[model samples]
Target: MTVDPELLIHRDADDLAFSVAARMITAITDAQSTGGVAEVVLTGGRVAARIYRAVAESPARVEVDWQRVEFWWGDERFLPPGNPERNETQARDALLAHVDVDPARVHPMPADTGQSAEAAADAYATELAATISALNDEKRRAVPAFDVLMLGVGPDGHVASLFPGYPQLAVTDVSAVAVHDSPKPPPTRVSLTLPALDRSREVWFVVSGDDKADAVATALAEGDVPAARPKGRNRTLWLLDEAAASKLT
Candidate 1:
């Protein structure tokens, strides 16, 4: 059930981070209240790092049973595990490490281990399918219906490494795919395809800075950008700071 996207403008990046942190905690708690584990797909960016730190430092952090929340990444750099550039490493240092989360439930994309990017993507897809199969009786999708799927819009209007005009944007058969020769640095990555990202109850786009304002506005206007493609099942939220929302009418 695709729905209209909602715009939430914050005073600044700091305010945006704290607000998102609170909202994330509440969302996780609400999902758990329904007697199911909270499945969250995390994104990586400067703004996201701030949000994670805010979550770790929030006084209401205890409201969520971190161990019951499953953490997954929307995309990752194909660097080795524990590399500072890896989203998993940043997330762990900023939030997951501080919380009492079950390490077994934190699913990061496969790192470069002498395997081809395509092979790594396939491995992650298999892991995602296995996890969903264990939790759901209906075999409808390879990925679970995530409680909250967070994403960061790149300056080029990319989300989860799905760059504008990239061929991967048209991929629908797989939950995950390998991205080669990325427009951004490192050139290689593994990302959840649009089908996988759209399998979520809430899709939150956490963006900040004036550099992203044009992309944000373009996406909200339904322009031909990758960021405009993925819509949440229940809600689509564009959580932006003032600078990021400045270009929006």
Candidate 2:
């Protein structure tokens, strides 16, 4: 069966956060009942952080098998640990710090690799292969389809580290790659390639703000053919606030 992405928009950021928290807990519990573990890939942004905070505060979060949930970043800022711009650091402050998850399983791309971006990219690819190998299933070697993926849409129709007008945005092989000259800021980052994204069973594009309305409409209306837009290649749901969805017909 094909997994379809769902967009559940809320009135504002707080409601959006709470809704995501409730669904994440529910999804984890449901998955855990059928299987022993639940793996989740996460993204970083104000919206994503809100979901993390909500998860941290929710009572059900403590009940889930924290030890059994292996965490992975959908994309990470290639900055030193503790850097304010790093997704891992943001996640830590937002929720990970409060959870009892296994430190070893929290797969935050190591930014301290003593090498150039190209070398670091290669190292991260190797790391992904090893992690997936350890977590593979009978049908798939390395990275059984993820239970869910929480993503943040950029103003320029980018998700994860796939920036528009860049060749990395069109990458297929190698699940992860190091990004340079990201239009946003802190240009350097490590992101999951399109193939890696296919690992998710459900992908959510949690978006807010008026500035993103144009990009939001473009991705959703442009269709899922990669030729149209970067976000179009996968099963994606555009969850937008009033301002962001205002222009949609």
Scanning candidate 1 in windows of ten residues, the lowest lDDT window is 135-144
For all predicted structures, in order, the TM-scores are 0.97, 0.89
Clashing pairs for model 1 are none
Error of 1 at 226 (Å): 0.3
- RMSD for each model, in Å, please? 1.8, 2.9
Please, what is the whole-model Cα lDDT of each candidate in the order they appear?
0.93, 0.74
Which candidate ranks first by TM-score, i.e. highest? 1
Runs in model 1 lying further than 4 Å from the true structure: 138-143
**How many pairs in model 2 have backbone atoms within 3 A of each other, for residues 3 or more apart or on separate chains, i.e. clashes?**
1
Model 2 lDDT per residue over 111-149, tens place: 855566666677777876777666675335343577777
Model 2 compared with the native: what TM-score?
0.89
